[model samples]
Target chain A: MLPTLPLGPFIFPTAGLVIIFGAWFCLWVIEKAALRLQLDAQATYTLAVVGLFAGFLGARLAFVALHWPAYQQNLIGILWPLTSGYAPLGGLATGIVAAFFYGRARQLPFAATLDALTPGLILGLMVISLADFLGGPGYGTLTAVPWGLSQYGVRRHPVQLYELLAGALTLLVWWRLVRGRRYDGQLFLTAVAVYSATRLFLDAFRDNTWIITNGYHGWQLVAFAALLLSLLLLARHDGNQ
Target chain B: MLRTRFEWVILIIVATLLGSAWIMMSQEPATAGSSLLTLAEAPIVGHPAPNFTLPGTVGQEVSLHDLAGQPVVLNFWATWCAPCRVEMPAFQQASVQYNGRAAIIGINQGEAAKNVTDFGAEYRITYPLLLDTDQQISRLYEVRGLPTTLFIDADGVVREVVIGAITPAVLQDRIERLLAEAGNP
Candidate 1:
């Protein structure tokens, strides 16, 4: 796997590079979408930056708190990044909270802001899937198909590529639906529904899922919940209209 | 105009899909036919353990070949590794519990003998601690990270490999599995 890329004397992790590029591209797309929607692009940019910083800090602090005994023994080890101690759930929750405050402080309409951000979010997901495919992290279950990739010396489904394809299709659907949309929050809800539905189906093929119990993935449950919430919101918006 | 924009979006999406599929198919398989096998290889799990001789803390050279017919727990650790220190007592306990039935060898990676000796004393480690000063043995076993433990059967086949700090219960379970694989009651 292309885990690391060598540039002269320096070594860079391909996954990290892909994620950085993804964030940059996502911000650029968000800025464009904000401009098109007549929202404050600068404020949107600030919100994204603040949310990312808060998320990173929250995840790191949560990780250190979990490994407090080890950090107590060697305080310097707390500074180490890329350790297998991150709490993604904590980061996600912190990011959403940060974004909400930033949005409120900027006096931006929540529905319009979410609609503007949907495309970039889908694109970012696609980039993450690409990174996963290259970095060999989120591998798939064993398969005998011709396109099955060799992971851990066995032919496995390229689930990351599957995710990428799903993300792309979701983005396209969002773009099509955004044109002449009747409701303010329709695009956002539709985007969420498409993305969550895609993830709910594709997560079944993932081998490294966080299983809750009885072979059910925690992420799959989350996806199903998100999908239902999106559908409910869509229906409510339509009824109001 | 909306229909035209929708058509463009569909066309671009199709093109992007075709391009990505082509790139994925054209590129070389990430792990295809590599000469070196990763540590997760199932075939290597049942294969003979790579033999190595290294200087031990007991003031003698210890070789894997010498421990024939005895299930061995080969632990790769370092003095500075927190997980290694955390699991040292469990390893020591396991060593004592299986005193005659199995042999536990701790391979210290590229560390000074004095440091390892001091750490061992602090942890009260009763197992043999071997020093891989040049990391020759670590490289051979593809030990990329600290605190990797390999459970080897009596016939010298590696039965299981644990990549992180293992609890005493897990260690005991793996040892029992290794012994079972070796046909020992």
Candidate 2:
């Protein structure tokens, strides 16, 4: 995998480049989906932008909190943003909270907002999968399949491709059937259910998936739970409709 | 009926995964080796730290194996990289804190020893700084960017590879993880 690209004597991290483009593309997707869902596209974009900023600050603060002792001596180091020190869980929690508040303040319907985000979410996942494929840590288990992409050494499963394919399929399904849906959040729930199923299948083939005790892939378990929850919500919504 | 149908779908997926777990699964500990060591002989996680002896900025030639039975941190840095400069103090501080328990070595990338010596003096960096004048060591380690740091456990297995500037907090956390993995802490 090419981690860095050398163009005109300056080397740029491939992941950084991909993410810059991916963020823009994902926002574009959210804006378009927002219009389709009859929500304010600009407002949705602003909510996402705020969520990202809050998530970044939350992640940095969480790291400082965890390693407070280390930062006591170098007080200015807390403001230094170059170093790698972040708590992802903190970022995720804060992002959700911030997004929720923004949506409410703007008088956006919760389920409708979620529906607007489904395609953008899928696009984000696809971008991450692509970045992982290029600058790794997302390679898959060994495989003898003809389409296997090489990573460590021997032929390995192209799990990123599998993920991208799944995202594309879900997005297609959403775009096609989202119109006049039975309920407001039906499309989001359906997409999540489908994504969770694919993830459960794909994580089994991934080499570096987070694993829990007793032969359980951590993501597989999470995906299973997500799949169940999404299906249940979708069923409830469909029945109510 | 609709709920029942969805429940059935859930049950089928659960059953399929449960059955497939027997054949091949990601949870098997044996399959979990250095995530980065999939490439043959690459100095990635789960692989032995590649062996190389480089001339220390001061005088002595330092070999990675010299730090055997102790955690080792190999910091690939350049004098010109600002992030590298920012983190050098933290590395110096950590080397003193975890001295003897861990070996923290700085490999200067393609810089003249005089410049490094001056920089070290300015920063008061006391760690053994080895010179990679030709960047052979960095190339071997596949370090594309400066300010890359590799944390190796006592067994000499590369545990973590961090690119970009490393804060004191992150540096401490990684070193602690290395010590814990090495069973010294």
DockQ of 1: 0.08
Instruction: Name the candidate that leads on DockQ.
Output: 2
> TM-score of the candidate numbered 2?
0.89
> Compared with the true structure, what per-residue lDDT tens digits does model 1 show for residues A50-160?
777788778766766755654575565556424334566687788889988999988988988888888788888888888777753466766789999864457778888
CA error at residue B167 for candidate 1, angstroms: 18
Kindly report the interface RMSD of candidate 1, rounded to 1 decimal: 12.1
Candidate 2 ranges with C-alpha deviation above 4 Å: B1-25, B29-39, B45-47
Local accuracy of candidate 2 as per-residue lDDT tens digits, A1-241 = 7777778877777877897799889888999999988888999988887887788789889989999999999888888754468898898889889999999899988888889988988898899899887865566777889999754467888898899999998898888877757778888988998888888788888866777776578888888778778866676665566
Show how many residue pairs clash in every candidate, following the order shown: 0, 3
Native contacts recovered, in order, as a fraction for each? 0.03, 0.41
* Cα lDDT of model 1 by residue, B26-50, tens digit: 3333443242243243313544688
TM-score of chain B of 2: 0.82
> Candidate 2, clashing residue pairs?
A152-B38, A152-B39, B34-B46
